[model samples]
Target: MASTSARDDDGMKERLRQLGLRPTRQRVALAKLLASGGHRHLSAEDVYAEARRAGIQLAYTTVYNILHQFTAAGLLREVVVESGRTWFDTNTGPHLHVLDEESGHLQDVAIDPKALPLLNHLPLGDDVEIADVEVVVRVRRRNDSA
Candidate 1:
């Protein structure tokens, strides 16, 4: 257990360094929670709640700021399902998501790129180039009686 804890700390430190973050006390604490247990999707409020549960004194605003910083640093990917709903994903690679409206839960959607609809005639400037596309499909479970 002790060795595992030490290894986790080392990994967190190295990850933060690569993202150009200073890895402060709060940052290290939050990063450990987010990056430790494999890939996860979390909102800023969820992150704050977890911090509080862990006895970490983190403010909501601070959580948002840290999440934004991590996203900007390329340590996390931001997924906005709607105007006010945003989630931070631990997986930085490009992928799709399926959001359950009733549960407000998001899960990864794995599909072949060839099956996806292509973006035709993008409205961009002459010097602009398309980089990536984010596809979010909202789904709800069908009721048995219906």
Candidate 2:
């Protein structure tokens, strides 16, 4: 089901409307791509390719615009795990990421908030909310693992 495109026949319209976005074909298709089957750390290019393969008929600018809108509205989290690629995650919870240096894949690594030391010495003047603390643990894959 993850690979199958379920946008057209599914009830994606209602979902987008609930998020205060008008349910257009482009928005519905993008929303379904983000919501259904499985969660992923997708890049804009990844989303554009998927939408194109699904015959969603959207320009690259349209995809990027909708993604920015969704991120601004708190529907997605954008992370820069690598140089030149920004990843979008459907999961909004505070967490860290483990990026495989060899494969360039990003994976979530949950951390206990209590485990972190208090940083009261630093001056954060009431305007800062620590949304995410990402520790990109870069590791090379073992030769014998496969």
Candidate 3:
């Protein structure tokens, strides 16, 4: 029987290969960490913290570089809800997100793409095309003043 770590490494290697990325040791380790908890939105700092908790030794720049590589390879999606703040999402599909203003966390918003009428009326020129749309709804706790 293969150990969990071995299985995870193999899985990460295969996934990276499919994405046309070389699965270096650091990449594999980071991929395993990102893949462990199903889908999530994580920053480089979040990943670095997780790696440290797991006793994995690597530099912060290594994590940041690997994250960008993964995003370029379509293995992850980059979500920027605020200026200078980015989150890497494991679920690389068409969907919207909800940002918690108080906690600074992101959650997936389930809505049919076709139901959005605004997307159908984008004012683009003939020479331009829309690549992707990212919508993040920000929310915070309401005060009891009212």
- TM-score of model number 2: 0.72
Candidate 1 CA-lDDT value: 0.84
Clashes of each: 0, 0, 0
Error of 2 at 78 (Å): 0.2
Q: Write the per-residue lDDT of candidate 3 for residues 26-94, one digit (tens) a residue.
A: 999888888787888998899999999998899999889999999999888999987999999998877
Give the alpha carbon lDDT tens digit for every residue of 49-143 in model 1: 98898888988999899999999998888999999999999987767888999999899866643345575555678797666667888988788
Off by over 4 Å in 2: 1-18, 112-115, 118-132, 141-146
Best candidate according to TM-score:
3
Task: List candidate 3 stretches off by more than 4 Å.
Answer: 1-4, 124-131, 143-146
When 1 and 2 are scored with TM-score, the better candidate is: 1
lDDT of each: 0.84, 0.76, 0.88
Alpha-carbon RMSD, each predicted model: 3.3, 5.6, 2.4
Q: Residue 47 of candidate 1: its Cα lDDT?
A: 91
lDDT of 2 by residue, 1-146 (tens): 54334544256776666778788777877887788647579889888998888788899999999998888767888888667878888877766677888788898877754345764455667988665555556678679957
Worst 10 residues of 1 by lDDT: 112-121
